[model samples]
Target: MYPINTISKGGLALVLAAAALGVPLAAAEPDDGELWAGAESRIQRHRMADAVVVVRDALGRPVEGAEVRIEQKTHAFLFGCNIFLWGRLPDAGMERAYRERFAALLNYATLPFYWGSYERRRGEPRHEETERVARWCQQQGIVTKGHPLAWNNADPPWLPDDLDEIRRLQMERIEDCVRRFTGLIDRWDVVNEVTHFDRPQFVTIRAPKHSAMWERVGQIEFARQCFRHARAAGPHATLIINDYRTDAACERVIEQLVDENGRRLYDVIGIQSHMHGGVWSNAKIWEVCQRFARFGVPLHFTETTILSGQQGRGRPRSTPWRSTPEGEARQAREVVRFYTMLFSHPAVEAITWWDLSDYRAWKGAPAGLVREDMSPKPAYQRLMDLVRGKWWTKLSLQTDQQGQGRLRGFLGDYAVTVTAPGKAPVAKDFSLARRQTNRWQIVLP
Candidate 1:
């Protein structure tokens, strides 16, 4: 048997006792449609306090639909995917093998609208591929997040040549892309990486093709303009200003954005968490996340991955993290540790993998949950266990105040009951799992 990490005696007891209870556990139900409608419809309705609280009882069951004791909510997890070049370009054939992998892993698919990739040639956008992916994602009941509608890397060759054409062309591209994928995507990242602290802003990396839109338009103004344009073309899309490095400056810019008077440039505060320098201590991740929680904008752990055993720095880098079985096993254990840690965080809404497989992963790190062959890795199974296998279960609550029982938990189907309160106790089951578009539902009252 593979060695599992150590846990507290109490936690270990929860696991062992549950395993011993093995008496034909109920098969976890697949999600149903119209279930998350309340949540989805409210996406554009509220820009602030966009999180939910998670709680549990003595029993180790994931409870759902618990009343918010606190006005502030911290949605346990809002699942997502980040469209990186490694996920798309050239070796996408490898992606074809793992279609089911992505379909199951994400509730939202984030498409990066790099100015160069979207409109490699003037007046010619990658409309075919964009529509193809967007439509498919919608059919699968997956909400869409269009990344970086405005970015420094978004400049076309013609854009940098003439300053006079920057605003006109930038606006035109934004309009075209937004219109092209209208209504299909629910959220759009208006800007990405605007703050430059220790690292350079996008313009520095893109070089000679830099723009006045980045330097002169001002990050906030650019974000506002992009959000306005995106809204004009695609109504009801949540706008976001996503940044990588979580420094004080980044926090300031995000705060400036969410708190602005007339222009609330961003709806969701997108934060990236690609921790390749070994697993980050729990405290570190929490510290960064808590800051975003202050702004009251729902937080999305936008683009994230933990390398198994790679060596590289930033965008242009090298080495695969897991080339052997031991390495692969280590990668798997890390995935569980990282996921369990993040899932427990209140502020983190979503955690997206840059790629589903290493076939075309940026700098080729074994960061994917599965292998290129579509085989399940330890990481994949752990995710399946959480995301699919045990999405819903029965929970027990010991009564607290006023003869009423109170407990905290996740968003999913749950059955709760009292064992020894009044004469003979009572039980209540709340089927709260989000309904799926593909499945049929018959409500039982």
Candidate 2:
């Protein structure tokens, strides 16, 4: 999609998660019928009970005899499989591939940054390959976005000391990439974990020159800088200022996004909630989503982890931990809860898990929904329930003569049973609505 992006066999293969060499999915069948049906049922019966999608002519008058297509704004869940940070995970190539597959199931792919590994080799940037995967995701009807453009861990060692130079370089990187991949992806996490920059190791490996990020530029100012420049690049992308603390720091960032002077700098408010032994409980996520809603911007739970183990990518390389059966089950249950919450939250628009399978998880976090063998983990089922089980279910819809069908459904796939009055009920399939319009070409028999 962009000149800067390069696609390779590495990202196309599941080999990174050991997903390649053979199988595609786990043991469960891929009959998307059930999931789509259930998800649609919720929309038709639960959400749109009082709402109506009336077909109207160009004159804004109802056309009864003329076939009608009811286009209603229905609530549906948006899901993602995470692309982990580099060095924390060894394969940059596979990062793109896994994200491509993630696009296949969910609405979009979420990529985290490992600025160390990204710029580790100097002049050569590691983003192109990932950018290639993002392009591929677009081809596959997947929406893609990065985790952070500016974060504590995103700068390399050779950064310039001059604020002008740093700003120029950072903006250059964001602009170049954004302009390159503008059409492929529309959203980005402009920064990450923005308020907590006190970590020793993160501070230790900083570039020799511009090591003082917060000191030189306030977090909000830096965030605004990122947003403005990235916006200039894509011109059509949604820039986000993201952070984490399990506290009120995120609120401050929200204030900046809504500030009279600084408000134009942001499009979405991103949050990081790694459910490390915890779950994104439906009620809790609904509450967390409220903060962003106060500012009237959409929300994204950007970096999420529901681990079945005790270790992490940021681990000190000495922690002792392992995955347990109970832990795996809990992880699965938590995942279901997480999706339920995001789907239910009025303002929460997207939810991205760190990885699909545990094979290449950052530092071996047992947070993958699938195992290395591509076998279904309990969490996989939890997610599959949303994708193919609930959201992607196939169901029947009735269409009028104009090739338009109306049905009670969620925001996904549907198989409409079109009967020509006395003709057989010929079922035609079409994917429902998502970030963009969902349309299908039907051939009548």
Candidate 3:
């Protein structure tokens, strides 16, 4: 078998040459059925952990045969969607539906930080609006992430002509945003799409000024500066390097994002899987995870899109695209498979859907989990089944002679209730985490 490092470092040509000379290459890609056959086992092995709950009386004696109830309160794994329409829906009813549906299903929310729209003016940066959204997410017990602290997707119209000034302002913005929302928003996509920083499409139309600044500073330095600024401002923040490309170019960018000590500066590696054209095969999804898992940091599927309507063909159409019954069914099935594969991979930490609703979805593609009327689609319902039903943990157990009740469950926050025959039931909360000991001790009054 070819070493993964060898194949990643431009050694594919050697494999091809060997194949032509009657030499066998690495193992063939596994079929879909074969790949999925091990998914449940993988999820159990990697995502679930064992815990011991010990119940004691006020006199420090074992409370034998105490009933212990465990119910998962939240997932340690982040299942999320971008909340661009948090309160921007057309009407109050739609807005309520959006909030209710999002909170019911997801525990993580990605807030937009696109530079052009976020800060239309030089001194103003929409802090109040972003705070409002972040506050709402916090109230709903959701984790909030700011996206694309530095990207050339769109440049603020007031961006200065000078490259030096532009660079200064960009770095300042990163530091300011990270500092200002230090606790409310702790995770950020520090540098987005750096591999395609100067793509022709962006340079010519959408972000000419920002593209020019990126070219002047060089990609690696530009990314390094942005990450450094963010780290300086929010030292404990989770910084990510995000890109849509999953090829060697993206890998090269990640390899260079290190500090003077050669330590990785970013906390997470963000991969964008915008499957507007079609869903990726199971093998490809597994391959991407395998390739990036070498980096040692967690992987976040940051921007994922699977269309529930006919994909755009030839050129963009002016009419709105609507989700179909057949397409929604297909999307639901594909979403389950996609999420199952990613969740089973130990390296992947989070998956964020691109849009929450079909209304004003990116490029008007029917990629949301809900339809335009703010109703849940099949994809949404099926995902809810997996994330909350099959994957969630709820169990009842009785304490043994040693006052300890042992059980295995998916990692998350749990509410534990201990009830003894003649004593009032005692309630407490605890978290099951891979990094911490899962043993808990509860004292009954």
**lDDT rank order:** 3, 2, 1
Candidate that beats the other on TM-score, 1 or 2, i.e. the better one: 2
- Model 1: per-residue Cα lDDT over 13-63, one tens digit each: 334433432211123321222222232322222212212223333353433
Using all chains and alpha carbons, the TM-scores for the candidates as numbered come to: 0.67, 0.71, 0.94
Residue 88 local lDDT, model 1:
57
Candidate 2 residue-wise lDDT, 1-445, digit = tens: 0010111222222222222111122333323243333433333432222212233334544333333233322224457766443223346655544544454466667765456566665567766777766766666666678766766664676765676777677777777667766776677887666676646666666532334655477756776777778877877788877776644665655556544554457887777787664665443553465434555566777778888765344543675445668878877776776666556444566777776767766556777776554455777767766656565443434434343544444664444433343333344445455334444543333
Residue-level lDDT for 384 in candidate 2: 67
List ranges where model 3 is wrong by over 4 Å.
Answer: 1-6, 10-29, 312-319
TM-score ranking from best candidate downward: 3, 2, 1
Backbone clashes (count) for model 3: 0
Q: Candidate 2, after superposition: displacement of residue 314 in Å?
A: 8.2
lDDT of 3 by residue, 348-441 (tens): 8999999989898888789999999989999999999999999999999999999999999999999999999989999999999875679999
Model 1 CA deviation exceeding 4 Å by range = 1-77, 83-96, 197-207, 258-263, 311-322, 393-445
